[model samples]
Target: MANGTGVAGASAATASEGAFLEVAGLGVTFGGLTALSGFGLNLEQGRLLGIIGPNGAGKTTLFNLLTGLVRPTTGSVVLEGRDITGAKPHVLADAGVARTFQNIRNIRGLSVIDNVKVALGLHESPSLLSTIFFTPAYRSGQFRTEQKARTLLQLLNLDDVRNLPGDGLPYGAQRRLEIACALALEPKLLLLDEPAAGMNPTETIELMELIKRVHREFGLTIMLIEHNVHFIMNTCERIQVLNYGQLIADGEPSYIRKHPAVIEAYLGAGAHDA
Candidate 1:
């Protein structure tokens, strides 16, 4: 369902590089309409990539395809050289993919730390007999899990609010907590969908610092979809632009800002008019 023009060329060029994460000829169609077509990119390990476009540019649709929320009509998603196209969300999580949504998703009544611990629990496999008998192995494993959760909270700057209910934290902190929970999965690739949707200028600035710190400290590869152009430009090493479900441009921050298609997508052809 792709336009069958530049997108094929883009996909070939991307696949030739053989990066850590490769998406080739990815497409999705609904009835007769295409939500995303020939969407492709190759991401190197441990780098930050940003995706930007106007609303309905299919940014979120791409995320859904990557995370298995939606199945693509065409193309393959390969991570670390393994084809994982159409894998279920949980299966992808087990294979080292973790994501935060555009909307905040927190366990309302759970403590900030408990929320993280809940996710961390997915990694442990203590025996039911051990749990029923209160065996040292189970108890020690639980303690270790809690300790790991606290460490993750500390890493994300949420340790001070560990005991507070997740919903009680400030909005910015809630976003960070979501990242912390995602990290509990020990993912190699992290997808953040509008992580700074409702922050003040100061908070946005802080978030920029936090994202860099997390990337540095954990050596994690991150992909984020954001409407905040300044935030994305300042934080991401590489940027990809989408419009009408096609990649208009992909390059370093400087190149993306100067790209004609990207500029046109954000501002109409007559944008320079008085």
Candidate 2:
């Protein structure tokens, strides 16, 4: 449910305005070691951008920096033209940024629908006192919230699991639930990390299609951290390559596949052996 507040129209807004997330000179450090250095990109409105590299390439760390999960050592992160460098996660969410983790973190005690309700709750007002008093506005707010929750569940085809406890879901369904929760926030920029980690090949293909549909229909600007080269290459409009926490390549999938340095840094051994 969306809390009767304005929704970002995630599937359609970017397709038209064509301006979305922008990142520049992004860097991150841990004590003495730099985990991410000078990473940057301009994600066009409504485009799916893939981030890929070997396991330790700082892919997810970049995500942490973007979502305020970690503060950048230096650089700027602007979303929809607003400066949000080092903004709190909730502040970022209120400003139309939402994310799913490398691991799902639904409220294990709540049902699928309740988990989504929490996202919608972020925008709901009328206060605990108002809710306890059952004022007209509170009643209306509750109604709107329920409607929004139902709509989001149906949008993600999780309506059947609405009543089921989040911890009871199958692996793939749990992943989708995390996405559904993020969508409930109606964020303009959606960050998905390892979305296909536990999916089977069939599930992977379907997940790719689902992702495309979400991006195209919702007008979402999607930035994903994924290891599946086929999934990344087939789905993203552009891809950024990271290695040892440094910016190594940035281009379309086709360009990246043929990049000499990229091949040398990542797929060189396999290509040479072949």
Task: Highest TM-score: give the candidate number.
Answer: 1
**Residue range 40-99, candidate 1, lDDT tens digits:** 777889999999999998999998898899998998899998788999988888888999
In order of appearance, the predictions have TM-scores of: 0.91, 0.90
List model 2 lDDT by residue over 4-120, tens digit each.
111122222223232466666778889989898876665667778888888888999988888888999887777777889999999999998899998888898999999998999
As a whole number from 0 to 100, the lDDT of residue 176 in candidate 2 is 89
- lDDT value for model 2: 0.82
Score each candidate by Cα lDDT: 0.87, 0.82
Please give the RMSD to the true structure for each candidate, in Å: 3.3, 7.8
Q: Which stretches of candidate 1 lie over 4 Å from their true place?
A: 1-18, 272-274
- Model 1, residue 189: displacement in angstroms? 0.6
Displacement of residue 260 (Cα, Å) in model 2 is 1.7
